[model samples]
Target chain A: MRDKNLNSKLKNNFGAKANDSRIYIFLVIVFVIIAAIYPAFFTSGSIKALVSTSLIYIIVGVGFTYVMIGGNFDLSIGSIINAGAVVTMGEFNRFYKIFGGVEGGDSALIKAWILAFACAIGVGLLIGFVNGFLVAKVKVHSFIVTIGMLTTVAGFVYTYSHGNSISANTYSLVDVIDKSFVKIPYLEVFTPRFVIAIILVVVFEFILLKTKWGYDLFMVGSNKESSFFAGINTVKKVWITFIISGFTAALGGSLFAVSMNAAVPNFGERGIAPLMFVLAATIIGGTAMLGGSGSVVKTAVATIVIQSIFSFLISMGMGFDAQVLAAGVVLGAVVFFESFSVYRQGLKEGERPALVLEAEQLRLKK
Target chain B: MSSDNSASVVTLKSNTGKVSFNTIANRFGVFLMIAVLLVVGAFASPRFFSGANWLNILSAVSILGMVAVGVSFVIYCGKYGDMSVPMVMALSGVISVEFMRYGIVPSFLGAVAVGAVIGLINGIVIGKLKVNAIIWTLAMNFILEGLIRWSYHGTQIYPDMATAVTYKTGFLLPLMAKLDPNIMNIDLTMRAENFNALAQTYFAGGIPLMLVVMVIIMIIGYFIQSKSSYGNKLKVVGSNYDVGNMSGIRATTIVMLAFMISSICASFAGVFITSVNKVGAFYVGAGYDFQAVTAIILGGMSLSGGRGNIIGVAGGVIMLGLITNILNLFGVGTFTQKMISGAIFIVVVAVNANSLRKLGKDDA
Candidate 1:
């Protein structure tokens, strides 16, 4: 009996590992299919561009991964990105105006950058704190709280900006943002943004796998009641995750401004395409939708997959509508298949039915 | 001991009077807010209490009320309500307008049938297969919006030709010709004067037919949720799926029915709203999902489900409409209106959480 139990546990770990690799396998298949149609997709230049475009979202999505892995939703991240973008840009411009010299120099730009960064990040932390306090401390549903935050923040951003785009003084931001300290073997035109994404993935993935805090966070996500009973500070852990989520999303916002040199109102609008993309990417990255587990590296790769899908559809003469539909179709298919596979796995395991186990647990609780 | 506890809960003068206060805040907050808003509105603007403006507020929120009532059922079933309501509304309206060549009533039926079909898809996937309703419906929202944009080439569908009214060849031609219900007592500009009469027609005493229809739907919803066995099954399943399943309730079927009812309501709202605009576009249904969800939550209904009622939901919807009207009278901008509503959403949800915490319960 002990041997059987050990073997099952081993198989479960091995199964999860296999599933993690499955996303990359699927991504490779997608690449191969695209390569068959367009040889240029295999070229280094387009690959670099693909990573460049997905880089910002990878930052936002990595933050989102923290919240999701900790078992929470942050629908307000898109709005956070909006607020961050607007604040950083608006603050940068305001400071730039005050500090501008007849002959522009780096010192003035550096000052603006520092102030802008502080204000932007401060705003994100504030919002994240509010979301965390309400969800963790007050115990409101994260979904409802974040939805309200989405609207209220968007309303404020719109009110402040008057629904117009704010363009910033870019040399200071561009010089720092565009610098590439690390080089890849094959990719010649790699940017620092790509490096930042890789670093975030590696660092966070390590923390999640190796740290006690990470384990507790997952425990909380898996079973909040049990985690609480086990003496985990579930509320604190959950609240901290929201802050990280907001922080990363806000970081992405500043990067967005740096890349575009502008904070456009479009991101905060109802389309919420960025939020949708991150959500789709996170789930596609092999994150368990019911929480308890996710991989930062896989999420990064998933971002690439989505970015490729966007280009693939566009290259095939499909319009923006096709791209939108494809997100829905792909997300829907993944979720449905995940559920189906779970159902099939349940039957295969011949374990007690989930409902029966749940019933038993309820009785125990009572 | 139970009677002593109840007596304390009932009497404000009791030692733990705060319990009574919390009970009222949790249970009757929406109704109280509606009453307060009515008083505040009369004070804010002379037009607020007038018969004509009151009718306008009813008309303005009629579509929203219908959708919210349906969403309340979805929330009651603990599915987080349908996120695809906006898309469903837009798609159904567009379908109705596109199929007008088949005659008016058939077109309406066909449009509503599309909604039912979409709901069926949602039901099967989320209910039978046990998928997450919020994500699935959100995906459906995207797919439906994409389909609309793809089919229409990102253009709004008009009523055949600049809405040029023609002498109807059908049986009701004389009635439509004599009465352009577009001009009937509503303050809204008749943008769709020649579009359709079903949406425009007013009942006796100038009560818009749409308001009447909405009230009837809410009444039916109240009965179904409060009185019907189906509703009891829904509450049982929603509160605890395993318990409901073990007790022999058809949990999947109840869930499917809830989704269908929600979609059907969206379809009804779609037809009415599309006629008002005289054009069908994806953007037309853009904000209804959030608004309806807000209204449902504001109605003192629990998002975790199996609590609150249709009457409270109606009060919630009316209160929203009333606030917007009062804001309009106060000369506040639309963005400010949204901010206030959004802020209200957060406050109300926090209060709701506080109330439920006493039972050692937390809503999703």
Candidate 2:
């Protein structure tokens, strides 16, 4: 019996490790195929651009993974990003005017940049707190609350910017951050944004995998009642996840704003596409939408893979609508296959999914 | 022991009373809200109470009401709501217009056929495959939107001259003339007139045709939902899929039927919308899915499903219409209007969650 137990344990561990590496393997295969189709895709410049553009999604995907793993969703992340961008740009412009339009070498310029970053992050935290409070304390559904916040924050962003793009000639600080450095083979370069995104992915991955809080979060998500009974503060953990989600989204938005050197009122108003990217990245990274398992590093890699696909599509001369359609198809196909696997597993276990089980219990009680 | 029993009985009586009161309030809340809005509108703008304005409200809400009714059907089956409704509406409208040269009946049938095909896809994926309803429908929406946009090459299609000529001198005019000779006089050439004006044509006592159609649909919806065996099966399936299946309810079939009904209603609304706009475009049904959902929730239907009625949904539709009309009268911008509606949606959902909790039916 002891030998049998050990063999099963080893098998389970190997199975998990294989599952974890599946996304990376898939990504590698996709890269190889793309490179075969377009030799330019393998060039360093194309790679650098893809990584740089994917950084924003990677950041947002990491944050969203936390929320999803904690059994909630933050649909308002796109609006948060928009709000962050607008506030950052608007504040910088306001500060520049306050300081007599100083161009460079001024303490006022630094102060303005600092204030803008703080304001952007602060707005994210505030929205996150509201989302957390509603879902945790008020017991409102996260989907509805976040959707409401999505519209409300979008409205505020438009109102603040008055449907205009905020632009300033004195965006030297942002420009510097966008500057590429450390050229790799084939003339590819990394930007500060790419480095920052990598650091965040590593740091968050460590936090989720190597901390007690991470275990608590997963426990709370997978079995809230048991976690609560075990004296874990599930509500607080959920709240913190939302705050992290909001903060990451804001960071992404601010980075985007700085890179572009402008913020438009209708920023992120294209609707659903940004959110879909975040979701697709996280899911492709092996994060289950039903909650309780995910990895930030995997998500970051998944974002790059998705972005590379987008780049390939663009190179093939597909329009924005076509790209969106492709993304949707990919998302649906992934989810369908995942669900089918889970359904097969449930059948093997001789049990229904939790949702059906809960519904059955509720009916029986009546 | 007798005194304790008596006290327990009193508490139980009060509890039952409170439950009934809550049920009543939930059922009539939208109507109460609408009544208040109507009164306030009358006081705020004299024209709000005018016959022309009422006709406008009815015509505007006719399409929305149809969509909301369809969403309510899906909700009744415990599927939350269908995100594909808007796309289905747009697709159906586009298909009908694209097939207009094939004649009116054939084109209309084509639209309905498109709806049926989409519905079948959604129902199979969500029902038999048991995919998440919202996500699956959302993906389906994107696919439909992409197909429509690709086929149209991002261009709008107007009614062809042949169809226009037919409307002018063909069966439509004669049908209208027979329905109301006074309204369809020779002075009004159908070719030069807006097709929507036909929808606005009044019957006896100045009742708009759209209003009559809405009333008929609502009555039929109410009967089918509240008085039919199929509805009973749907409720059972929605209430508990596993239990219903165990009890031989064919839960998958019931769920698919609910989705089919939803798409059928959406197709009908699409035809109406096309008639109203006289043009087919990708954005024709934009925002209707969310709007319909908001209306259904405002009608006190639980998002978890197996609750609410068509009458309540109509009241919700009217309440939304009044709110928008009042906002427009006050010159509120689109952003603010969206914010207000979104806020209201959240509040209603929160309240619904609380009620579900009280019933000990929290999904969590």
Candidate 3:
């Protein structure tokens, strides 16, 4: 009897390990497919591009991973990106032109870059702070509150743009933004935007994994009741997660706009596509969607894989719509497969006959 | 000693009175917002009282109203409301248009059937497999959108030339002919069809069909949500699955039924939308799902599930129409209207939360 109990425990642990390995194997397959398509995809320039895009997603995903892992949802990430892009672009254009040597010269670009960086990061933090306040302090469900924010931000974007694109030429900062930095095997890829994205990811990742506050957040997310019993400030942790989600999304939006050289109302409008992809990857990385376990590294890797698949699909003569469809299918499949175990478990304990039958059938097949 | 114990128990009950009221009110808060908005709009806008504007508003709301009715059921069943409403709508519309060349009946039936199939898939995933409704439904939305895009490739189909002339121009011919005849009148710079009709056609009389259909759907929703055994079972299951299971309620079936209702409503909404637009595309139902969600929220429905009524959702649809109409009267731009709408939505939700909090405190 003792031996049987020990064996069952071992089997359960092994099943979980097997599940984790399945996701990793799937991610590796995606990477392999990309490499098989284009040798150049693995080159320095492509790597830089891939890393840059991944960096944006990774930053945003890190914040959202906190919320999702913590057991909340935010639909406002897309809108936050739009809001972030508008803020960063507005600042870059306004200051860059003022400091442009057309009025003064080379020194003007540097000054504008510094100012743009500050504003972008500041705007992100501000949005994050508001999201945190509303969600944690006011005790509103993040989903409903975020949907409202989505519409508000979308409206703001349209209003701020005056229904037109903000051109890069208007702000002479376009020149400084286009300048790329090469750092041997790995390009530091210095754009005022790229630099900010890297710094935010590194700093935020540290705060999430290495700090007491992050641990508190993890505790609160894992179980509010237990956290409260342990004297953790659960509400504060919830607030912090929302804030971080908003800030990171905003920062990502700004970087994307800076790279594209314009802030259109539609800029980051479809950011949900990338956001969902990041979510799938984060979940696939063994980060519990029910809230508690997540890794910055795993999420970063997933982001890269997603971006590579997108680029590869585009290269294979797929249009924007097809690319989106393919990505969605891939994401759905991954999540479905990843959560299969939990789903199977739910069925076994469930009183529903249909679910029980299905579970039995699945077991038989396996 | 028994009498003394009774007195303390009464005091304890009184102390907890505040919480019950708060909880109940929070559950019905969306309905309150809808009522308040409609009342405010009716009084504030003179044009709102006109028969034609009312008809127009109802016509505009029919699509979203139908979809919201479906989602409310899903919420009541305890699963996250399916987010594939837009895709389902588009699917039905696309299929309808594809088969329109055969006749209206074939097109309509085909679309409805397709919608049913989609709902079945949703049911299977959410009910049987127990996939997270949000992700599963969202994924389904992508697949539908992709299928539509891939099939249509952005090419939109217009009504048959004969149908176009007969159905569309027939209504306008009398007005157009009258305008041409009166062209010589100095005061008739604008045609009667254009100017006189715009001012005079304040009430559309030929819309009983849509109104009747809308009421019928609401009645059905009411029956399913409030009166039916299935409905009561779903509520129990949603409130607490363990309790429901103990009662022998089939949780998966209730969930599946909810998804089916949502899909059917989405399909019906798409049919109405295709009628309104006279064409369908990938973006046909793009924003409709979100609008329906907003209506559900506005109707005092809880996102967490287990509490809502069709009457509330109907009131919500009416409120949404009134808000937009009122804003239009003030010459608000689309962007401004969106901003105001979003602000109002958030405020309503906040108010609901505040009332609930107050109730909680009172109970404590």
Candidate 4:
């Protein structure tokens, strides 16, 4: 009996380790499936496309993860992306006019790209600051507040643009985005956008893992009251995180607009997919959705894996609509499956399932 | 025990402040905005006060009212809702139309069943697994959308030949036809003929089935929320799980029951919507979850759980209906209307919180 008990404990410990490793395992399995289906998936062209798309999503996802990790959500990101697109395109257009560039093509394209990106990021920061302030300081839950913003800003997109598309005047930016560049190939160039995504992940990972603000974020996420007790100035951390999230999402929006070559009014309306997919990626990467305890690196890798699976599916003749349906089914099933362990624990304890909620709060205490 | 006394004392203290004062205050924030809007609308448009305008308001409120009723349960239970009400409504409409080939009853049942299943999944995930209700429900929403899109191949569901040609088009058609010719140029009327009439007309052209149903559901919801032992249990569960567990309430079960209630309400709304609209689409429940949530918040139901009743939610629904009506009467643009509604929602919720705080309970 003693030996059996000891063996069971060892097995349990190993099981816990495996569970933690499940996300990585899942990513590998997905990649393997993609590779098996499309042998050419590993080629430079495919990798470049996958990496570029993954970079855009990752940038936005990482910013969003910051808010989720802090125990809130920003439904406004999609609309914000739309807003960013509008802002960038509008600003780029005006700048081109002032600088007297040729219509639809430009000698000043590179400088215009830089200026547009900077302006886009600024707008993103401003929106994020407002969102963060309303939620943290004004004491409103993120959902209601963001929903309000979604409408107001979505309206602004229509009002400012009068429901029209805005295009950048920089042909060079478009040229750089659509095709290869130099011998490196923009597709395989490890472009600035890709580099920016990586840098963001690394910087955020370091800050979250090592900085005082990072610790405060964890504390606030874990338990708001306790964080208050710890003198973390919990509200400031919450507000700042939300603001940073907004800023990062805006940057992503600008890049996305550049890649797409036009800023469509519906840009933000399509945020549902990005929002849910990012959440799934974050959670699958072993970040607790309950808040805190996640890494941007994990989210970044998971984004690649998810995009690859999606691409593989598309390549295999699954229509775009079916893929959308499949994503939803996958998300629902994954959340249900992953959370089953906690439910089972509740069952074993002969306690009501509600007892499991305590685990979320309990983790914070630890 | 001491804590129990303290809580009870607090509840009792707040109970004396005008039976519906809390709800009124919560709604008052939005009401104030609506009042301003009414003044502006009346000044802007001469037709704003016509009896026809009031009828238009009632007609418009019917469809969203169905959704709001269903979501009220989820909010009341403190479950984060964002489930596939839109898809459920759309699918229910589709399935119903398909069944209309066979007969009316079959179509109605098929549509409602799909809605119930959607709600069932929502309940299992949110209630049983204790996942983040909003995230889980949001996922479910997309999945339902995917299903609807795939099944329809991204097309809208239109009325069936059998229903359109055979059964007098459910009962809302002719009434709307008559009303449409005299109305303003605004095209917001339910394009599907049958729905407009059923919602607009009642028995013998007097009371609308939609309004009757709304009232019935509201009353039932109120009874469940206030008078039933089960309702009391849910209240305790939502208010504070620890205290509820100590009090011998199974918080998980209570929460699940709440979700089930919400799903049923959503299903009922779905069937009625199909009957009325004669069509369903991806955008059916697009902004509804948030809208209903806003209404609940404005109704003074605390987000932290267990503080208000269904009557409060009813007040919110009515007020929201009123605001939409007033806006339409004045010919405000859709984009502007959305902004006004959103801003009003935020301010109303804020004011609701303040009132709740003043009363000594956390407003959440």
Candidate 5:
């Protein structure tokens, strides 16, 4: 009995670990193919650029993974990003007006940066609260609520900015957070956002794997009624996930704005692209769309894989539209493969007997 | 547990009677809102009550109504909504115009055929393969958008003599043209003249041609949804997939049929839109997907499906058109209008949800 228990336990552990490691293996395979096709992909400059751009997606993907795993979608993440970016830029402009011509004064710049970050994060949290309230309390479907919020928030952003891109002359303020660290030869690149993204991934992964809340989230996702019966506040857990998702998307958006030194009202105009990327990353990371299963670390790695594909396509001189098309194809192919594998696994796990019995019963009745 | 069972039974008894009441209230509620809006519009602006303006509103929403009818079918089958509708619309419009050399009948048929093919692919993937509807359709949308863009090299195609000839002999011309001899100028071979005549043409009592087409489609959609065995099976499948399968409903085939019907309707709408605009562009059908969805939901159809009808969807299309008209008359900017519509959509959905709960109806 002891040996049997040990054997089963070992099998379960291996199975759980393999689910995540499979994505990593796929990522490595993709990297190898890309490197072989374009030897320049290994260059430090290319790697740095890819990481810098991918960090934002990774951050958003990590947060969105929580929402997806909790059986909900945050489509408003794109609009939240737009709102965050625009709000941050707008605040910066306000600070600039108030402190007119700071002339390299570090104090004034630091204050401006602090204010911008607060405003961005605050707006994200507020939107998230509303999303959670409606979806949980009002019994509105998350998809409709978030889609409406996407339009409403986007309109607010455009209205606030007068449908214009806000360009700030205060490079000093943005540069504080945008600065790089530890330049390593030809790979010298912006490391602040990359570090932030890495920190978020580690923190989220820890929370998702090691905490009771994480377990509750998965339980609620897999079966809400069961979770309810188990005394878990599934609604509260879902609300928390949306808030985290919103907060991360906002942080990433604001960071992007700071890096670009401008925040256009329509920055998230490629509305579905960021969403598609987040979903693709999450799913590619072995996250089930049906909810209840996913990993933050796997999602981060998946983001890298997707980003690498885009970077490769860019190097091949593909335009934005072509890149989008390629991403769609990749997303479709990944989901298709994942669904097929899951189906096959089900078939292998004694589902065939039940299915055959059902079929035979139908035949007999006919 | 015994009390819970008793309560559920009581609710079930009350629900049977309330179902008809709820349906009537839901359908009537939209018209009531429209009436309220019409009254407000009349008071707000004199032009709102004009026959010409009413016709404008009807004609403007004709394409949307057709698309909503298609979307309603998918929703009826419990497939939330087709994200590929917009792309299908654009592609079909482009195809119809592109194939004008093959004559009008063939071009129209070709456009619908293309739509059916795309729908078949979506149906097979989503139904047979059991893929998530939203993601698969969304991916299909991207692929279609890319294909259309690449094919046209991101340029718009204007209707030419061939298109004009096709329109002239097309069945829609007589149905669309006004009864007045002076207004129904069908002989105009010039593209602009032909388009203007078609645009200005209305049936007796000033009913637009597209409106007539919309009504015909709605009737057909209603028949397929309510009268046909396929429709009955679809309702069963939508309400409970496991139950449907147990009952030998062939849930996958019904879902595919729903998608195909939706695509066909959207294709017809595409042809109508291109006819109205006199141009076929990749962006021609942009934003229609969301608009149709909003309309479908507003028309009393739940996103969870298995409820609502084509008539309700028509009311939704009309409601949307009326809202736009009212907003435009008030000199609201497009952005503000979008914000208002978004808010209204949420409110409608919330109320619908509350009503559904009160009715003790299961979502899926």
Candidate 6:
């Protein structure tokens, strides 16, 4: 009994990876509960709809999680996604003209798809790099830098699209996005989007957990000064996270554009809603806001779980307002609980979280 | 803080015995930008630098000015912005307009009270509980906005003339009637006309009453941030709460007051906005929270708290207004103007950050 107690404490207190199991357990419980209460949730159609609806959020969120783990924010993801969508269409439009507009054939279609996707991701990379440069090198707070990016990007997209939705249905990417790679009877069908999202989760989660670069990024976020002393390139690590975040967001945005066959940017040009959702989702997924910890897989699973909870509420006849309200309530409660836990944990440890400790040293010096 | 600032000045003088113009230009970049904007406006268009246009710009920015200064207090205290500003505005305006059958004073009073309550909750949850300010307030924003939309059936509430009734009180009744009938004090028929005329009515030449309120808020915000002991306490708290606690400051109270002050200000802006649109909906002030934050940052308010100037923030607000006005004067389309304004925001902030870095004050 004594040994077991010591083991539990050791496992729970020191490792960022420990919470991974609890979240997975929670996912299992959520699944069982929902499955039992609303058996229709087991239906393939319901599952497919659920995954489809949450796929983009999950995809954007995976990249967002990397940034959060590195202790910064990329608030312009939604706008980047919007930009991705716009760029995809613009590229496709230009390339389609060159390749052959109406009778473009499969070759033109293939060419446009490859080029558009590459260009869209390229834009995301560029924007993300700029955001990184501003925050890391220019020494601006990440929040304001990303916000500046948001406004600039939104403005550019709004100008490009003239505040109207740009339809790219003719490009045929939408039809390709929903193509099912695998079908599960009475449960769900795995579309290319869902497959890509999972593949991203697995690959990024591995990199985040096992790579030296990933470890350095976490160190920088957990304590920049210490990491700097330890000879980690704190600047480079933080900057790299922004690029990853930008790439993922851009990928999600372009995919969204193709899936919808239109760049419906009027709603998301400001990027606030997507930013809010990703923030809420990451926190809910158990990524520490103060950094030093997160899981891409957990965030993806949590995104799906959150969607399920929404579906459950809708199944209970809750209106759209109820979903929004519930989301807010859940987010608030989670943040409050998370902070309270940290405060309590600090009391036991006899020192506060790094956020407070760092601020204390810095401010008192002045 | 003033002494500290002056001490720096003295040391700089002792070290060099003179000030570099480049340093001054970088340090007072916001002010220099405003001057640049003014000159550019003058050169770019004939109608850009007129007295009337300036008033138009000032009046146009007053609502945002009220908000930026309002949020500045919270930033001054070192909290992330009140993400609920937009919802607070929407809900408070709807509440005030719904109560407009009561006198305008009472209506505004009621709305402000509601706003204060929301602020208090934020204070408790964020200040006392130490929740992440950004996410918690964001949650509060979503919850309140969702609740308002749900209850109101996702529709904007237009002021109803038929339901308008002047809530009469003692000796004030006569004064209210005499001054109010022009604005449909009693009903919807005259509300728009009265609102238009009231908006047009300037308290000072080329300066409206809202601008006056904006100025007063800035003065008060500045005074509280710098001169008052409370302000010092707030800076201490913002700089480091644990340290502030050990030093015996009522950190909780200071934070609560900061939030309450912003929310109260939001209530006033809310009413102004609702009246301006003559309707209340959840979408009202949708982007104001972000816009206000940008203005604050542009004005030289640091995000880490305990470091900023309200006067610079005021200049930031004016620069934003100037950007829009100048762009319009140049006959730029709406889409292009947004791009230009955003670009300006990034460039100006980048320069500010670079200068601060050069000064050996790092944000990252």
lDDT value for model 2:
0.78
Task: Give the per-residue lDDT of model 4 (tens digit) for A1-366.
Answer: 545554564466777777777768887888787777689778787778888777767988887778878888887887777778888888887777766677535456556666777888887888788888878876777876776787777777777677889887555676565454444643464676677777898899899899988878877887888889977887888898888888877888787888878888786243236666776777777776668667788888888887888888877888766778888887777777767866776667864333454564568779
Docking class of 4: acceptable
Pairs clashing within candidate 5:
none
- Kindly provide the TM-score of model 4 when superposed on the true structure, using C-alpha atoms: 0.85
Q: Which 10 residues in a row give candidate 4 chain B its minimum summed lDDT?
A: B165-174
DockQ of 3: 0.29
lDDT of 6 by residue, B301-354 (tens): 767687777888898899989988988887899777767767776776777666
Candidate 1 retains true contacts at a fraction of: 0.60
Could you give the candidate ranking by lDDT, starting with the highest?
1, 5, 6, 2, 4, 3
Candidate 1 lDDT, tens digit per residue, A143-204?
A: 77888898888887787678888888565567657555556644544576667677877888
By lDDT, is 1 or 6 better?
1
Q: Candidate 1 vs candidate 3: which has greater DockQ?
A: 1
Candidate number with the higher DockQ (4 or 6) = 6
User: Candidate 6: misplaced stretches above 4 Å?
Assistant: A1-20, A169-171, A182-188, A268-272, A351-366, B1-17, B21-23, B160-207, B239-243, B362-364
The residue-level lDDT of candidate 4 at A86 comes to: 84
| Model 4 agreement with the true structure over B200-319: per-residue lDDT tens digits | 456764546777777788888888888999888878877787898799888777777777676667766776776665566666556767678777776667777776677667667767
lDDT of 5 by residue, A178-275 (tens): 45676775546657777788889999999999999998999988898999999999889988888898899899888888888899877634423687
State the displacement of the C-alpha of residue B357, model 6, in Å, after optimal TM-score superposition.
2.8
> Across the candidates, what are chain A's individual TM-scores?
0.87, 0.89, 0.82, 0.87, 0.87, 0.87
- CAPRI-style quality class for the chain A–B interface of candidate 2: acceptable
Regions of model 3 farther than 4 Å from truth: A1-27, A36-40, A94-101, A104-123, A170-172, A183-195, A268-272, A346-366, B1-45, B154-204, B357-364
Q: What is the C-alpha lDDT of each candidate?
A: 0.80, 0.78, 0.69, 0.71, 0.79, 0.78
C-alpha lDDT of residue B36 in model 4:
71
- The lowest-lDDT stretch of 10 consecutive residues in candidate 6 chain A is A264-273
Best by lDDT: 1
